[model samples]
Target: MSGILRFLLSGLAVLLTSYLLNGVHVRDYWYALLVAAVLSLANVIVRPVLIFFTIPITFITLGLFLLVINALIILLVDFLVPGFNVDGFWWALAFSLILAIFNSLFDDITGEKAKRNQD
Candidate 1:
């Protein structure tokens, strides 16, 4: 199903992103899968709270502060996940940006067919 495909693609993105960044390390494919799942959960649960609390700064920065929130989420995941590691805040920021790009690319690849079917 598309849900399973999306999950797998997300894991692939994580693995690929880790490979692309020197400061990011993922132990293996399985860990990448775990990282993807945790990252999704963090985005769902933690991200909203962060956005709510930092609304003023987020607004002041013209939405750039969301990148900081993304980095913080990566750092939090690095703390919670054993096999996935981000070297530091800078590394976390780089990892997050790269991951977002990968995720978007993968999503477009997978989503195009679904959109065609829907149309």
Candidate 2:
């Protein structure tokens, strides 16, 4: 159940990114859903390998290289999925930053602990 909800939220975040950014286009909600799933899978599978290979650069940049990795993942998804397009590297970078913001906001909104009383 949580997985389904998380997927839906991620899809919504992708749609939001499409709307908010000029160079990113999601053809429809279905495409957004597919993009979200692929992006998640890429993050899980490809990102770690990338991090391992780029550790020296990542360390040199004081962890900022992760943003580049995130943008690359977005570009990878764009390449793999039709109907979801990211125009260029700059656009992918902007889309990735915005998507991260939206995903964090979504997590806060849907988080179980968020509903718990502070008392």
Candidate 3:
């Protein structure tokens, strides 16, 4: 299924982000794949609750606090599994930036969603 391919691609993105931003000690491709799987699961299950809790601060910061959210996501991934290790908050922030860039490019190339109909 395309979903599986997308998942693999997302994993690749994570691996690439690790290399470019954080010093991910991934032993092999499988490690990255595992990290990707865990990251996705955490995002789906835990992120909403975190976002809800941070809403007031997020609003106060005029949405820049999303960077902290991203760092937390990275920390959560590191906590939930092995093979994905970011050194600190700065590395996590860099990881988040790379991940966002890679995913946006992937979605654009794959036509993953409809363009906004600005009318």
Candidate 4:
């Protein structure tokens, strides 16, 4: 799918996931789109540095420590975005895991799987 399409779909995923989890309150879908755009940028920029810095912990935990990183990212988003509230550290952890799983499935269905498989 095109980048615009992917972006829009990802925004939808965020909206849905936000509704499912108690993490964020979106005023409307436009707010969700804004949240998703910030999230995508953060993932592209912030996540790499985090992964690099935490490689030791990741290795020690056999990669399970990624959950903590994900939680931190989620918490970061909550802090950065007004009206998007994360209840607690544990809530961030749970919310990110669910978001990750759901977004993976969303991407897979939206031609991401084909693109990756082709690559």
lDDT of each: 0.92, 0.92, 0.80, 0.81
TM-score: model 4 vs. ground truth: 0.87
lDDT pick, better of 2 and 4? 2
Residues 1-119, candidate 2: write the lDDT tens digits: 87799889889999998999889999999999999999989999999999999999999999999999999999999999998999999999999999888888887888833654553
Q: Looking at model 3, how many pairs of residues clash?
A: 0
Candidate 1 local distance difference test against the native: 0.92
Count clashing residue pairs per candidate: 0, 0, 0, 0
Model 3 alpha-carbon miss at residue 47, Å: 0.9
Candidate 1 per-residue lDDT, tens place, 12-88, comes to 99999999988999999999999999999999999999999999999999999999999999999999999999999
Task: Decide which is better by TM-score, 1 or 2.
Answer: 1
Tens digit of lDDT per residue, candidate 4, span 53-80?
A: 9999999999998888878887888888
Alpha-carbon TM-score of each model against the true structure: 0.93, 0.92, 0.88, 0.87
Tens digit per residue, CA lDDT, model 3, 1-119: 76897888888898788777635555567888887788788788888888899999999999999889878888888877676677887888888788889988887887775433332
- What ranking emerges by TM-score with the best candidate at the front? 1, 2, 3, 4
| Alpha-carbon RMSD, candidate 2 | 2.8
Query: Which candidate comes out best when scored by TM-score?
Result: 1
Q: Which scores higher on TM-score, 2 or 4?
A: 2
Ten contiguous residues minimizing lDDT sum, candidate 3: 110-119
